[model samples]
Target: MYTKELFHSWVPKVLQKIFLFVLAIPLLVGSSIYTANMGDMYSGLGTYAETLTFANYSSTIGMMVGLGVILKIKPRFKSKNIIVFAFISLGLLTLAIGSTQRIDIIVVCSVIMGFIKVFGMIELVVPIMFIVSPKGDRGEFYVVFYPLILGASQLVGFLTANLAYNLNWNAVYLMSAIILFGCALLCIALMHNKWTAKRMPIKGLDWFSIVSFTAACLLLNYILVFAKQQGWFYASMNLRLALAAFIICAALFIYRQRTAAIPFFSLAIFTKRRVLTAIVLFSLMGMFTATSSLQSALTSILQYDARTNATINLAMIPGIILGGFICAMWFKREGSTRSLLFIAFSCFLLNTICLYFLISPVVDIRYFILPTFAKGLGMALVYISGGFYFASSLKPTELMGAYPVVIGIRSFIGTAFFSAVFSWGLYQFQSDSMMELANGMDTMDAWVQARGGGMQLYASVRTQSTLIAVKELFGYTALAGILVLVYILLHPFHHLHRRQLIIRRKRLKGESIDGLRAESFDGKDITATAASVST
Candidate 1:
């Protein structure tokens, strides 16, 4: 969100740009490092759900709070100084996570790290948003930013995963801390806060909504992540607390938002069909078509080590770069929002089909190339088109509200919560498949035959069951892609047909067609204007 003017007095152009770049890099690095090392962390902790939930839930809450803080609070120090503090804090916490063996300690450190990470990320971008000239190649900068971080994360993850393999899990995190320390140093050296927002006292702040929402998110995340492993109703005391807390906090959150003088969430945002649609599309894409799920499938089922899997995943980087370029060019040239959406959906559909055909327990690494590439392309197209569409739909001042709501809901909660759902489904499917296979082996000979002559029979069955479960998951993902494709296709039809109907009414009224002109929504005319909206 751009302020009416630069937040504080302008600085030298080159120095300001440099500060923005330096400030921006750390948050991406911290995020990438954490994700890259998650597998090792999970192994050390010895539970997938618990490890992931513990690592992610805090970060999500922190981001949500940071979003609010950025909008509400104007710090006394320059934005860059706040970022420097956060970077130092993050570096220390990362080191702590590396050194600590106790899960409880790790969890506490993670929460603290999350708080810092949010401030780091929010402050990191402050200069870019507030100081940089709006006329600069901002679109191009963003076009490069997303794919670069994504590809670099994969590369860094590969390297750290290798470190984990050769040395230890601690080695992976130690490297991360060292790298973060370097980043902190860079921030300290290069970043200067020449510009700062005027300090404003936060007025009419709904503390209850903030508390309720935070509690709801944390509790619900735990409940969702652990429910399958811990059992639904009767397994663990933590589970009971998670469920009760989630329900009570969630209700309170909703009520507080409704009653607050300034609601934390404006329910009015959902009234805009396009905004709501974009959120749904992005959320589903984040969930069912998640790259993390695919990575887990490669490692856990196909038994490819992280290094090899990462190399296979390199195929995606090219696609991401190409897709971002194409999307940017299209927006600059044709500027067809509808067409961009169609392209995104088409790529997603192609990715799903490619994956459906490619997935198998014994599938070769080469088989992943096309599908991953397609997904990367689809991801870029969706983010570029969907992001532009969402931002443009709102008034410029509404950007702050949009950022937290969209990013928090679609990226953080959507990814973590859906990944949990997928994990739970995979476990259920594996269990059911294993049971079916075991039951079908009725006779001794049949059992022996099915078990491959009693040499690691159960292990063999588990592997097969896991493979089956993954395939079923892919099938479901394909179905979701189809639904998205249909939705994207149909959404634009109403607007196009309505325009045509208006044109016909003007003609019927004997209005001059030659002099009648209308502004295009994007740069492109609706190609499907002749098609009936109802169809």
Candidate 2:
């Protein structure tokens, strides 16, 4: 009802801050909800493998496109104004996705929704960075913001699933749209026009690079998602197309980056060992947080309904919030980030190990609480510390070009690859277990069961196979965790102790360690001894 100019001039400071917070809430939550409840969407769209694959692949492609656009545009408009339009776009897309019964239509809507969601997410942060004054003690506010968004998204994602299941599934999307629309109005009312930053001119955008990179990303994602279904490399047309597209586009993209005056990505900063280390950490974080297999185990083997699953996800938030708080406090106290990462990885190892033992068809939901909480805590700690570590590793100029590619790999590629691996593992384990069980069956008992076979036999076999597969997945994850833990200890902590001891012994004889200062991945100077570099 209010004009933007009139409302911005008259709004109170307290009310404007409240509006800012409100606007932030919806940006990331829908994307989380879509991801967390994908199985539900799979069911709603009639449980076709091809449909789910295309829907997911299309959505991710759209996200890459949107990310490209965001990176290209830089900061041109009012941040709040960008958010307002983004939310409205999301609302419309959500409604369109929910209203459709046809899988094809839903897939189209999802792609658009993904595109809009990415745009919304990137824009959402711009306003906060611009408007929120991080002076003196308030400097930690910026550090805490992403985790806050993450926690909220997790909570809302679960709640959205619960709502979708209890009422009509479509209702959740419609209600979300209405809520976002209301938030958009509030943004118009509260955000002022005076806050403007110098934006990079749009003319500098590398369109060719954007297109090539997006094509490569999309093709790669499609292959990852659909390779098993398409029989991998030789059989499916999809795989063939994906491979050809990916190879060509990737080569072109690389060539452009090397040659262009204004490349879409500046790969030179990645020459730093610390930046590469952060990328590895971020990728691992994505792999660790790929919870789809775990959720599938709960739903398929343990028979948890949507509401119960939602409740379990909801329980994870408190632990995540606690971890974030701990990290923030530790950072303020000048606690070592390397130590925090060790603690985080240790927690992750614990979570994976616990889940490895605790998962079974007969296990109750209560058994998952501790392990899930640990997972959440570890995730938050890694995310918070890792963000700080990555930021500190770079100069201010390096931040812009470095983040998009690193995050693209971390966010999309890491999860997609792990999910594919998990799915393949499940299929392989299930098939092998079924074969083993079949071979060991008693002849007379098998004959009787075969003679009386119906829903009961099928259900029993499915449940058993699924249980075996899930347990195998947990075990595999635990083994992977062990490897990660060994890496963490060796690279970050264990080696540092040896270096320190060598330095101490050398200093006792008045050795000159003054020329030994080297840049460490933890954003500190390490006395680089001969032994340090060799290791």
Each model's lDDT:
0.66, 0.68
TM-score of each: 0.84, 0.85
Candidate 1: tens digits of C-alpha lDDT, residues 124-240: 554454343244333444566666666666676667767777888788767767767777776666545464456545565678887887778777667766676777558788889
List, residue by residue over 289-374, the lDDT tens digit for candidate 2: 76555656656667777667767776678778888688767755666666888788777777777777876667788877887788
State which candidate has the highest TM-score. Answer: 2
Query: Could you list the CA RMSD of all candidates, in the order they appear?
Result: 6.2, 6.1
Off by over 4 Å in 1: 1-19, 46-49, 129-133, 136-141, 191-195, 201-205, 233-241, 439-443, 446-452, 492-499, 502-513, 524-535
Superposing every Cα of model 1 onto the true structure, what RMSD results? 6.2
- After the best TM-score superposition of candidate 2, give how far the Cα of residue 474 lies from its true spot, in angstroms: 1.6
lDDT of model 2 at residue 62?
Answer: 68
Worst 10 residues of 1 by lDDT: 526-535
Ten consecutive residues with minimal summed lDDT in candidate 2?
526-535
Residue 181 of model 1, lDDT score = 76
